[model samples]
Target chain A: MSTVLEMLSTPLFQRALLAALVVGISAPVVGTFLVQRRLSLLGDGIGHVALTGVALGWLVGAATGAARADAYAIPGAVLASIAGAVVIEAVRARGRTSGDLALALLFYGGIAGGVVLIGLAGGTNANLMSYLFGSLATVSSADLVATLVMSGVILAVGVGLRSALFAVSQDEEFARSTGLPVTVLNIAVAVVAALTVTVSMRVVGLLLVSALMIVPVAASQLVARSFRQTMTIAMVIGGLACVGGLLVTFTVDLAPGALIVVIAIAIYAGTAALRPLWHRAARPASTSEEARADATDDPATHRAR
Target chain B: MQLADPGSDPDPLHLHGVSVAVAGTTLLEDVSLRVHPGEAVALLGANGSGKSTLIRAALGQVPVVSGDAKLYDVSTRHHAARVAWPRIGYVPQRLSAASGVPATVLEVVLTGLLGRNRWWLRRADREQALAALEELGVADLAHRPFGILSGGQAQRVVIARALVRRPDLLILDEPLAGVDLLTQFSFAALLGRLHAEGRTIVVVLHELGPFAELLDRAVVLRAGRVIHDGDLPRDHAHPHGAHDHLHVEHALPSEPPTQRSLP
Candidate 1:
């Protein structure tokens, strides 16, 4: 308890906490739509591609003799991730092959390319481990600012395009027929999702970032009755998991990213187990009561002369 | 193949010399259809007889290989940028609830209004959505989770979603394909009401069934060619007058909308 309080007062802890909270809120906001669209693996695909960008950033910095090469990593990763998402969209539009096949190619090819690039850049195992497992405590103040601004923009965009996004996610063909700019909306969502994955990689690591994007939203879906409720609840669950994992990391020797994922999975499991009991508790009353209400409310039952 | 008949019908929907082929297989060949104002036309055919493909081509969902597909006298390719969607309402085929995201009936209906230029839904938007539900007699279901509704109720909610836009032309693809018999009666009744209100409708069906009384014309396809197009022939395949009890005229307060002439 004393150590947690002490850590909370430090600037390093403050920066990491800000990054975690921003990621916690923003990841699931975009993630709910991704899960609804059945593209939950998109985060993992983008994260793997971001690794190539991160290693490339390091190489460019080393060649230029920059003081801090890591500072260029986030932009490089974001660019690569967005490009990967666009390529996936292009492949889907081609109609030449199955969408899943294209995504699988990107998913495996990205990681393999990233590994080779990291090796060619002369990166040590420690540097690779930081991006893989995430060194949350090492987040600089600049990273904190970037995470805040990026997450804020993501949240704003999500809220602004909520209806169009929901429409496209539910039925793309129908949305297009209604003039909702289905293609543009889909590309916008993909770009935002890529941004979320890139920023979240610093806190949850590239390998486990998808868990943060999908797990909390999945848990929320078990209980939430509406889309709005599901989005709000998923964000809250992610935020809670982040805070809980951080506090635990302060007290014990554990990887924060792994702990956060474990906490999210625990929440999903608990929600799933308790869902049946909750349904029974909240079950609607008897058929007789429902029929009575329908008799009173249904105009079709009362014929007009 | 040649395009549509060179007639000056000025219909709401007109397809001229349309052909759609996938790979080496011909789905529709040399097909032309025109849906005039205040007309309810049913496209009928057996499975794989090009019933779905023809409507898909008319809606510009599938590319027309040879001819032109126009809506409100505007080419479908340029329709979106020309502010033409507000005049059209489309309800797709029924989808399973398991394959959907959880949303309230109201939220699903509100998606109809999303094609407008507004960024946020206003109070008037909510009221408009409720009024549409009320028109369909499903206002009580506004707050219910859409995934929990039965097939009949879900269909009505989807119709309400389309109707909220107040479209002059409504298109439904297999609206009663999966619902119970009782639900079909309600759908027939709703179509009757829409017809009396003078809204143009184009529906796709496997058979006339309960919709026999509401159709102005029947256009049947056999292997992508229009084999029959004229008045509906009375048949003994299904019982008629199943929806006679639900034929009450709706009490709409507003006068019939004044439709615009073809540009």
Candidate 2:
């Protein structure tokens, strides 16, 4: 606890922790929508695509002899991720049964492309590797600022479009029938999801970013009764996981990305295991609200099983 | 501002030579039909007879290969087609019981009012949703998870969703499918109320079932073409009886109407 307090007092550690907290909050906000729509792995796909963007930024920096390529990396990744999102949308829109197959192909193909591009960029710098495994120590002030701004934009959009996103995600044809511009909203969701994936890669790394996006949401779904409640709980759980993982990393020699993911997975497992206990505790109270919650809760648990 | 007032002139929906083809196989071909204002028209056919596709085509959900689908004289293909959807409320078939997300009955119905113009639900919208649910007698189930509801209860909620918009045109695809018989009568009663409000309704049904009384006309389709587009026979039509369902096969014309392109 003394060591944690000492580290928290440092400006660099504070910035890195703040960045992780931002990711913890915002990634799950967007993730709840994706998971509800059964697109949980879309974050991983976008993360892989973002790697290519990071590689391209490095190549551009090398050619221009810029002081740093990291400045261009996030934006490049955002663009590349959006492109990959559009491709996934297009494949699904084709109404083919093989669309899932196409997405899987794109998912692995993106990672392979990223590796080749990173190799061609000819940078043996540990900075590139840090993007894959995540290093809180490497989060510069500039990267922190960019992460905050980008994450803020994503959060605003996610919160603002919450209703429309829920409506469209739950029922596309019905949303369209109500004049909700289902196609545009879907594309917007894809874009926002891409943004979340790209920014979260800084905290969780490209390889494990999706775990950051999905795990807390899965845990929240087990504990919360309503859509709104689920989102709030997921955000809280994500923040806790981030803080807990960061503190553990400080005490031990471990990769921040891997440790964060492990922490999130543990939270999910813990939530699932404790769900019956939660119900049992609530059963004694037996209030109408509890009864209603119990009524709603069973089908969801059954479906999940 | 006012409840729907039906007129004979501009039909709420008109499918003129609409042909929907998916992957080189025509789902609906040369389907020309019209639902006049305040009319409760039912599209009847066996599965794969294009009843659902025809309704989908009219809503511009499916592509019209060689003809036009118009909602109240506005071409569904027009750029402004989206603006006209608010006037048309649509209810999909009842969802499967195993759907993972447990949206509240109110939440499901509230989505009916969500559109490009209104992304957020106001108190007025909430009241409107409540009123619609109340109208369908599912107001008590407003806070209940929709997935937990019985088939009949769920269908009522779906109907409530459609009625929330107070739409001039209501299109329901298989509203009675998987619904209990007792609930089917209740749904018929609900449709009767909508029809009395002078709303134009186009519903797809495998059999007339309890919906017989509310149906002003029945359009029967066979192999993607309309076989019967007028009155149902007296013997086959149900008149608000406790039991009202005719075997569609026995009721359909034995010779079958000659398949021809709509001019």
DockQ of 2: 0.26
Q: Which stretches of candidate 1 lie over 4 Å from their true place?
A: A93-97, A284-288, A291-305, B1-10, B234-263
Q: lDDT for model 1, please.
A: 0.77
Of the candidates shown, which would achieve the greatest DockQ relative to the real structure? 2
TM-score to true structure, per model = 0.89, 0.90
Q: Candidate 1: give the TM-score of chain A.
A: 0.92
Report the interface RMSD that candidate 1 achieves against the true structure, in angstroms. Answer: 10.4
Model 2, span B84-113: residue lDDT tens? 777889988646333344567888889898
Quote the positional error of residue B143 for candidate 2 in Å.
Answer: 2.1
lDDT of 2 at B102: 51
Cα displacement (angstroms), candidate 1, residue A138, comes to 0.8
Candidate 2 — which residues are off by over 4 angstroms? A125-127, A284-305, B80-82, B94-100, B237-263
Q: Quote the lDDT for B108 in model 1.
A: 84
Interface RMSD of each: 10.4, 10.9
Clashing pairs in 1: B3-B17, B4-B16, B4-B17
- Tens-digit per-residue lDDT, A128-224, candidate 1: 6788777798888888888998898789877677888888887776776677777888898888988888888888899998999899999998888
